[model samples]
Target chain A: MKLTKFAMAAALLTSIAFTSCKPKDSEIKANVEAALKADMKMANTVVDVNDGKVTLSGECTDAECKAKCESTAAGVKGVKTPVINNLTVAAPVITTPPPASTATVLDAATQQKVKDGLKDINGVTVDFTADKAVIKGTVTPANRMKIMQILASAKVQSDVSGLMDKK
Target chain B: MALQDKYAQLLSAAQTHGVENLSVAEQNGVLHVSGTAKSTADYDALWALYGQIDPNMASGDLMMNIDVKAAAGAQLKVTTDSTNLNIRSTPSTEGEVVGKAAHDEVVTLVEKTDDSWWKVRTAQGEEGYAYAQYLSPM
Candidate 1:
C-alpha cells in the first residue's frame, strides 16, 4: 500500500510540474512582444495573446514583416497559433513630384521644427539633419512658403523643393 | 454604454474623415471598426481619438481594420545618397527595420504610406519602407 501511494504522489507531482511549465497568456504576450521588438522589422508590431493563441496587429510595411511576426509569435513558449490580422501593407504609389528645385540646408533646430509643423500635413514628409531640411510630398504653394520661412528664420538651409506635387 | 456606443465619437470621426465602406460591430464588450482611411492622417486621427478615450489602449475593446491603399506595382530607385536604405515595418523611422535595400538598388514600390515613407518590396520579396528622399521613380 505504501508503494502504491508513493507511485500516486509521484504521478501527481509530475502532472503539477507539467502544468506549471505552461506560461500564462500575459506572459506569452510579453515574451512575443519582446522577441518582436528585438527585431527591427517587427518593432512596431503589437502582440495580443489569449488562451495560447497570438494575434499581431499593426501596420506592417510588407508581407515579409507580417510573416516574420507570425513566425516569431508561434515560436514563443505556450503560443498555439499566431494570427496576422489587421496588418496593412502600404503599397507604393506613382507620384509626379514637382520639378526639382534648389536644395536648402537648415540647422538641426529648424529641421526639427519643419518636421513637427508638417506632421499633420497630408502626404507631406519632412527630413532634415543638423544642416539641412528636405521636405517632400505634395503641398500647397502657401504652405510651402510658410515652411521655407520657418527654415529661413532659423538660419538653416532648406530644400522646400522636389516631390512638391501640388496637393 | 455598449462598447460600440462608447466609441461613437471615434466612429463619427472616422466617418467624417471619409473612411470607405465603414462598418462597426460590437460583441462581448469589444468594438470592431473596419474601413479604408483616405490618408495616413485620417487613419491616425481615429486612433488618436481612441487614445483620448482610452489611454494606452487599456481596454483592448476595439479592433480597427482601417486600411490605406497605394499603387499596386511600381518601381522606385534607391537614392539614399550612399548609405543602404532601411526597410521599416511602418512608414515612420520609428518603425522596425525588417529589411534593407542597397543604395541604387531598384525596389518594387508597394505604396507611398505617407510623404516620408515609401512601402517597397525588394527583388527577394523582403518588404519595408525606404526613406522617401532615398527613393525616386525608375
Candidate 2:
C-alpha cells in the first residue's frame, strides 16, 4: 500500500513540473516588447507573443528588413519561434495641403464689410475672390473713396476703369 | 525692448505650436534662438518671421537653430486592435497607402508630423506616415 501511494505522488509531481516549465503568455509578451523597444530599426513594428511563438507585423522597407525584425524578436528570451506576415516593402506616402496664402488668411467679416460698402454703387459689384478684391462696373468718386477705405487692408484690383481719374 | 525681446512674438508662436526644447538668449547684439519644431510648417513659419523681422536676412545677428522633431530614430511599437494599420505617403486618409504595419510590429519612428501623423521607418527602410493614435512610443 505504501508503494502504491508513493507511485501516485510521483505521477502528480511529474505533471506539475511540465506545467511550470513554460513561461506564461503575459511574461513572454513583456519581454518581447522590451527587446524590440531597444532597437531603433524595429521602431515601427509591433510584437505579440502566444505560447512562446511571436508574431511581428508592420511595415518593413524590404524583405531583408522583415527577416531582421523576425530574427530580433526570435532572439528575445522566452520566445520560441517568430512568425512574420504581411510586412510590406514600400515607402509611406505623404500628401499635405498647400500652404495657406495671405489672401486666404483674411477673415470673412472683413470681406463682408468690403462687399457691403460697395453695394449702393450702381452696376458695381465688389467681390473678393482668388486673393483679390475685385471691383466690377462703375463707381462715383465718393463711393470709390468709401470702397478704398473699407478695403484698406486688402490689395484692391479693379475691373471697372475711369472710376478714379485725376481730373 | 532688447534684441532678444524683439523676438518675443516668434517665441510665443513657437511655444504655442508645440516646439520643444526652446531656448532664447541674447549676447553681443545677437539673438540666439533654438527649438525643435514639430512640423515643416512650423519650422517655415519661424524662418519666415525671422525674415520679416530682418529683411533679406541682412542683419545676420539672429542665430536661430530650429530643428524639426521627427521620429526618424525613435523605437515605436504598433498597437492596432486587429486590422492592420495603413501607412500612407501623406498624413491624410486620402493619401495613397504605400505600406502596412501589422498589429504589434516594432518600427522606428522617423518623425511626428504635427500631432496627427507620425512618420515611421520600417526595418527595411520603408518610410511613411501612420496614424499617431496607433503608435506607442518606447
Candidate 3:
C-alpha cells in the first residue's frame, strides 16, 4: 500500500513541475494583448502565443512604431525572448498641391520695380513680357540669388532660361 | 506636387525654424514660398539648404522670398562685400548719395521705405535711405 501511495505522489509532483515550467499559451496571449493595448498605434496589432513564444503581426505607421510593438510584446511576463515581429510599415501618403493659377501679367510699374532692383547688379538685364520677366545675363551665384529675391519681392514672375552662370 | 516633394526638406525646415506668416503656393509651374525668418542666420541657413538641394538653384522651379524679421529702430549690420553702403536721399538709385556707412557698421533702421530700400541712421547721426539688400538685421 505504501508503495502505491509513493507512486501516486511522484506522478502528481511531475505534473506540477511540467505545468510550472511552461505558462498556458492562452494566458500568455492575453497578457501580451493587455500590454500592447497601452499604445493606440498597437490597436491593430494581433498577438499570438504558442508554447510561450509571441508573434506580433499588424500594420504599423512607421519602422519606429513597428519596433515599439515588438518590444512591448517581448516585455510580457510569460512571453519568450525574440518575439516575432511581422509588422509592416504602411505606405506614405502623397498629397497633391492645388491647381496652378492663370498666367500673371506684369504691369509697367512692376517691370520698373524689377529694373530698379537690378541696377546695382552689373552684367544683368531684364525685359518684361506679358506675364514674366525674361532675364538674359551672366551672374554670379550670389547675384543670381539676389535677382530671384528681388523678382519675388516685386511679386513678378521670371523666365531666367536665358540667364547664364558667370564663370 | 513634384516640386513640393523636391523641396520638402526646405519647407520642413521653414516650419521647424518658426517662419512667421509662411505662405506656399504653386502657380504657372513655379513654387513661390514667402515668409519672415526669425533671424538673419535662419534666412541664410535656409538659403544654404536651398543651394544644397538644388545646385546653384539652377532648376528655377522654386522662388524663396524669405525676409528677415526686423522692426523700426532695429539694429542692422552693413553686409556689403567690403564696400561702403551708400546712403541715398531717396529710395531709388536715382536718388542722391547723402552719406556712407562703412562695411560692418551697425546702423539703426529708420523705416522700411519699400522692399528694396530702407531709411537708416548711422552712429554719427547721418540718416538716409540704403539698399535693403546690403543691410542685415542684427
Off by over 4 Å in 2: A1-13, A61-64, A86-90, A94-167, B1-138
The lDDT leader among the candidates is: 3
lDDT by residue (tens digit), candidate 2, A33-72: 6776776766788777667777888777777777777777
For each candidate in the order shown, give its overall lDDT on alpha carbons.
0.66, 0.63, 0.84
lDDT of 3 by residue, A5-107 (tens): 9999999999989878877999889888888888988878998888888888879999999999998888888788999999889999999764322234576
> How does model 3 score on DockQ?
0.20
Rank candidates, lDDT, best first. 3, 1, 2
Off by over 4 Å in 3: A1-105
Can you write out model 2's per-residue Cα lDDT over B52-96, one digit (the tens) per residue?
A: 765434343555655556556877777555567778888666579
Per-chain TM-score of chain A in candidate 3 equals 0.51
Q: Cα lDDT for residue A49, model 3? A: 83
Lowest summed lDDT across 10 adjacent residues in model 1 chain A is found at: A98-107
How does residue B26 of candidate 2 score in lDDT? 64
Better of 1 and 3 by DockQ: 3
What are the fnat scores of the candidates, in the order listed? 0.00, 0.00, 0.33
TM-score of every candidate relative to the true structure? 0.30, 0.26, 0.61
Which of 2 and 3 is ahead in lDDT? Answer: 3
Highest DockQ against the true fold, candidate: 3
Error of 2 at A106 (Å): 29
- How would you order the candidates by TM-score, starting with the best? 3, 1, 2
Q: Residue by residue across B1-106, what tens digits does model 3's lDDT show?
A: 9889999999999999999988898876788888899999998889889989987666767778788999999999997766788898987777899999999999
